[model samples]
Target: MVAGILMSLRELRNIYELLFCDGVIVAKDDRRPQSQHPEVQGVTNLQVIQALRSLKSRGYVRESYVWRHHYWYLTDEGIHFLRQYLHLPTDIVPGSLRRVSKATARGRAPVAQSGPIPRPEGQTDRQQYRRIQRLSVDKLTGVELGSKPTPKPG
Candidate 1:
């Protein structure tokens, strides 16, 4: 049950990332990874629906239906949560450097007063989601993710 929940959360996070980065969610007909629309590649239509439902239940996403298709967008609360989830601080008011510096001195990381977080090694959201999926599969199969398999002595 926990594994299933974790997988669902992973899917939810992927969906949130897609909306946050791409500003929209639409499952492509082709499920190939090399598709032009990387956002929907390798993501099933059912997975998209499930993720959207989870986000909607948490009030983080809103959906619109038109012509038998569903469109998804992040709510304000969703944007706030995404910022925090990405470790981009959103609470730094202007002219608060003194307090920020004090907090830093006390060992807390200084919050960025503005601007997006610096890109770290340029890893895309798709790559991150794939990594998470790999880890979850590894956990479920009792194999250590990112670890070398032990060799048997001949």
Candidate 2:
């Protein structure tokens, strides 16, 4: 009975691992790796949806939709589940969740001064936007406009 109740998550391991690493996954942006067969390629977002739904039914993930885009967050149990699947230590911290340095944190925090905000260095009241050169598609494709193609050796 217990075995039947707790279904294996082998097939959904990729989705679980993605959540463990990213904390949260945007359904539209989710993609699985390509398979061995050339024609198989990779699974689309639909596969991600199926995996998420399976995990949700198992109480390992929570789902929310915003602006017609689905979002999934890993639950506490999901972390454990992923760790078990990956054979990782329970205290493993994902790269995305790395701690911020004190200086970086301080720079981002706003000061509580009661005076008016100061202007940034080298900036006047009005800031002009600069127009940078756009990349040329011809250059990108190695086919420069008006350039003669070299003949191949016979």
Specify the highest-TM-score model's number: 2
Worst 10 residues of 1 by lDDT: 92-101
Off by over 4 Å in 2: 1-11, 29-41, 95-98, 101-154
Local distance difference test, each candidate: 0.62, 0.62
> Which residue pairs does candidate 2 place in steric collision?
none
- What C-alpha lDDT, on a 0 to 100 scale, does residue 111 get in candidate 1? 67
The estimated TM-scores of all candidates read 0.43, 0.49
Q: What is the lDDT of residue 64 in candidate 2?
A: 94
TM-score, cand. 1 vs. native = 0.43
Error of 2 at 129 (Å): 18
Q: For candidate 1, write residues 15-107 as lDDT tens digits.
A: 666677755676544434344434644445656666666767788778887765677777777777777776556662222112445667689
* CA displacement after TM-score superposition, residue 143 of candidate 1 (Å): 79
